[model samples]
Target: MKFQVIRLRTLLLSAALIAALFVFCLLGNRAILTVSGQLQQHGTPLILIDPGHGGEDGGTQSADGILEKDINLQLSKKIEALLHARGLQTQMTRGEDTLIYDAGCKRMREKKVSDIKNRMAMIEAAPDCIFLSIHQNYFSDTACCGTQVFYSPNNEKSALLADAIQKAVITAVQPENQRVIKPSGKEIYLLYHAQVPAVMVECGFLSNPEEAAKLTDEDYQNKIAAAIGDGVCNYLNNKQS
Candidate 1:
């Protein structure tokens, strides 16, 4: 009587628990499959976004204590999201704030060299991929502020891509920007040696107090990311036609 009722109740509870778990897992898997399908259906050739200067090397700094590495990472992430939303396949170098050097490299100089070499290897591995390196500029004259783009000199597509991105940024994000795209010099080892189209975006000058504030804002960062995404889309569309 009473004992039989308790046993039946326990069995019912266990069955309910099992059914709930099954439903949860089923829904989760379906969600993953949907996203995977979306990515595969519209994916483009890989676009590698490298957020420059990580780990111990904090590239540049502003008067207000903002670090360039942090800014680069934040902006890169935003750009990645925007590009993905537009159905573009994207990859990142050093997704976090860490130097991606070979494990055995010990000294600071050795690590820096290893980091760049490792980055170059990634670029070579995806030979057909486009590369976008995100960085901030610092000048002795704080008054100098605007977005400037540098492209690999040897690749004609690199120049076109840089020009498109610069134009997009100026028109969409910073109307006052008047900077032009230039050929990357030998100082940028990765860009100079890159076989594929490569461009480095100097987002803004951290040396300027006003521009530094805008760079740190979430809204402004999204605008910049959207502008970059538009530029990449424009370049890709133009390349196809």
Candidate 2:
């Protein structure tokens, strides 16, 4: 009876040791995850998302009467949510269909220029931030379609970001899309003169009837937003490595 009690005590001790080891490992993993999250929050730059055109400027319109500005804002908001879920910071240029120009500007043209300048100033102030302008494309040739990303010429980092986003969109949303990343020219006011890394994502060609329909779909917009979030995370990871 004495020998049996000793064996039972030994077994109980062994089980206790195993349980203690498991707890230690669990705490160690939690500590690592916390540290990892901190690093991610520290290293990743805030994303400045600009939903192009608003108010008087309806931007391009599809044959079905869908407005580009509305679609841009919707997609931008979706992307912002995904970024937030991934623990990344984000800022939006405009949350509603209103002009951001100074109150002094009364004329429509004056308001447009002032709004653009204000956006530029915001970009300049946030030197470490990544700028993403969401817009839809319109072409006389309805044959042209697919999402295209344009990066600022002033920054090499913009090209890398554009490529990452473009690849993500193609891979996740449209596997058949063969669109390539292009550099912004003088035509793009914000991208042409940006001091920080910037990319304008042309979500889709509104000129194409089929693409326009797809762009209006909520599910499709969500997929695009999730892909963009993945691209941003991937870019940040690569930068850290």
User: lDDT (CA) for every model shown?
Assistant: 0.88, 0.87
How many backbone clashes can be found in candidate 2?
Answer: 0
Cα lDDT for residue 103, model 1? 89
Per-residue CA lDDT of candidate 2, range 36-143, in tens? 133223366778899999888889999889999999999999999999887777888899997789988989899999999988987876667889999999999998
Structural similarity to truth (TM-score) of each candidate: 0.82, 0.82
lDDT of 1 by residue, 40-105 (tens): 222255788999999998999999899999999999999999998887888899889999998898
Name every residue pair that clashes in candidate 1.
Answer: none
Which residue segments of model 1 deviate by more than 4 Å? 1-43
Superposing all C-alpha atoms, what RMSD in Å does each candidate have to the true structure? 12.2, 13.4
Clash totals for all models, in order?
Answer: 0, 0
